[model samples]
Target: MTEKALTIITQREDLPQLFGKRIENQAAIEEIISKIEFESRSITFDIETKDGQATCRSLAAKIASAKSALDKAGKAKKDEYTVTTKLIDADRNLAKSRLQALQDEIRQPLTELEQREAQRKAQHEANLAALGFVNIQAHDHVGSDLVKERIVFLENTVIDDSWEEYKSQALEVKDNALRILRPELERVKKREDEQAELARLRAEQAQREQQEREERIAREATAKAKADAERQAQQIAQESERKEREAKEREARLIAEKESAELRAKQQAEDAAKREREAIEAERLEAERLEAKRQANKKHRDAIFIAAKDDLVAGGVDEEVAKQVIKLIHENKISNVTIKF
Candidate 1:
């Protein structure tokens, strides 16, 4: 009987281009396996040859031979898978190393150039700030006629890598600005000083005028007080002279009234004495006249009695009876009777 071989062909299209050669090597191994003589599913050999049936022992021998061929094919496929995976890992590692080296080479010069540019920009800004000319549009005073040309020149200038040119131009503009500002500052100070001096002089003049006005008021008050005192003294002197003249006139009138009263008392005393003397003389004359009348009446009465007595005696014729009738007649015992002889 001719011997037949069992083989398996491995096909893989998913592998990378770098591992495509490994697929050929795997194909050669598959050819070797196909040439091997074994009892398998693809290769057929009869265990019972022209006999009625086969016993269990012959079937066991055929199964053992088929198992050995299957084990060899599985081992070959496992070995191929392991070696191909290792080759792909080595290729990936080589590619990563090459890419890292290329990146380092390209970036080194670019980094150095960037660092230098940053440094130059910082130096330019610092120099402009020191000159006080940064953001020039914000300071309109820099464009004044005093330093306009110099300021405009500095503003238009560009800053290169050389620091010396920028510094020299900025210092020149600063000097020009100071030169213009110094004289104006001095002029303002001089005007303020002159105004202050004028104010002080005016204050002194006002004070002097006020002092003179006060002195004049005081002198006028003193003169008015003296005049009032002199007028009061003259009034007092005139009042005293009037009182003295009134006292002297009253004393003279009292002396004249006293002498007149004494003369009136003497005249009244003389009139009283004359009236007493006249009354005494009239009383003495009345006493003498009454005495003479009493004497004459007595004589007349005696004669009448004697005659009547004689007539009675002659009629009767008795002397004694005649005496008695005469006596009765003298005594006036008989009334309204005449004696007849």
Candidate 2:
């Protein structure tokens, strides 16, 4: 029987869904049992006569189907469609009997699997209970909302009345349990409390750092803006100064040009005046020179005329005047002249 049990255990472990489906079917039967609502005084035979036999038969048929599927899977070779010699090698009745024996053998391992599942659930609850202590300690913290960055930890579930009340009303239970369990529960609770405190402190520090970083960034931006404004102002001032200097230089150039024009005009006027004076002085000097030449020519002509008259008066065709007169008397009865005086 033990050997057979081991064999069925191995088979069920090898094919868990076959057994899992069977268990699910059993749970459905229990659900049906709950729905019937039998009084305590009710007899078993009455229920069995109506629904129990039918349910058992249905279960048997399903079991048979499961066995057939297992047999087929076992007979299947890894690379071929043909059954292996393990089944073909056995007597036909013996193989069928061995397959049938597996159903009865399935009970114990399934119970053990349930037990292990229960233990796993218990451990999970214990861990949750310990974490609940941390949650309770965190109630005192002001900004726990900020600290809880991840998903919310608590969720609700429905159970049987007794278990349901225990979950819904865990506070009274925890307090009582803490009193009895003493140092163990206390230690776990204290550890979680310490962790929550540490998390809170770390969150505060991070907030401070974020604020400081923002302040620094703002200061740098302000400084850069101020510097840019100052540079623009200086540029504007320089441009204005440059324009002013250009205007002043233009003014100076215009003044210089005007002064040069005036000087040139004055020099031309002076030159023209000097030329006119020279022309007038030259005309006067020419008129004086012509008058002096005319006067000297008249004096020379007068002197020549006087000398000619005297010569004519002093001598005619004669050498002596008395002789010339005697000649004249002899020719006519005119008076004679004195001889030589």
Candidate 3:
């Protein structure tokens, strides 16, 4: 509403002949865009005003129509060009195939020669590589043994016509590789020798240090043992006086105990002898008493046996037979006829 609400009413007469057609009119489209841009400046869209909103709707409708028409036109043109593009591509591909075949046929011998030479060159390169020609820096830190192997391989390589036109190149490569590798091998050998010598020196130093350490330890131990022995001797000397006194006291006490023990032993021996004499006298008296009892028993037993034998003789038994019967009863040879003694 700052300006007056305005609209541009475009008709078909204002457009180019190809404006919504299958052809693109660059100049005409540019003119149409110029005209719209100039007219759009006048049409200020103010949504707060009815007339401004109406003008904005009309311009939007116009732009939408133009956009639709342009899209349809592009589609129409593309649809028509599709067949022509396909035909051109088919002819281009066929010509490409035929021309490629002819070119291949024409260059067949050259191609074969080129391939053979390429293979030959590849073999030469492989041989050179085997001789350690490439990546020489990779061996800068390698060991002497590997470097010697490379030198040996380079020296062993036969440089002859079998290498073909590259024979001289192969020789040069071999020579250069050997030139680099030989010095490297020597350097490596020198370095290894230095390393071995260094290690030997270190080992000898370590052995010397170890021996020194052992000797120091042994000296320390000897000193410690001597100190301990001195201390133990001092302690033994300190204890010797007390031990001597105690030993003398113990010997005197043992002597007193021995004298008392001897006295007790002599008294015990006399008591044992008296007890033995009393036992023998008692035993002799008991033997005499036992003998008297045995004599009395024998006399009673004889009297009983004689009385019984006389009764048997009176009962008409023979004298010798009665004697035998009495003897049998007296000796307890007859059952149930023992005389009580």
Best by TM-score: 3
lDDT of 3 by residue, 1-341 (tens): 11222232234433334444433545545554565566666566778999878888877876676666555655666766788999999999999999999999999999999999898888878876676553543655668877777677777778888877878777788878877877777778888899899999999999999999999999999999999999999999979988998999999999999999999999999999999999999999999999998999888888887888899999999999999988888777999887655
| Top candidate when judged by lDDT against the true structure | 3
Clashes of 3: 0
Candidate no. 1 TM-score: 0.22
The candidate 2 region of ten consecutive residues with least summed lDDT is 149-158
Model 3 lowest lDDT segment of ten: 1-10
Q: Which stretches of candidate 1 lie over 4 Å from their true place?
A: 1-262, 303-341
TM-score for each of the candidates: 0.22, 0.23, 0.40
Worst 10 residues of 1 by lDDT: 9-18
Candidate 2, pairs of clashing residues: none
Q: For model 2, what is the C-alpha lDDT against the true structure?
A: 0.56
The C-alpha local distance difference test score for the whole of candidate 3 amounts to 0.77
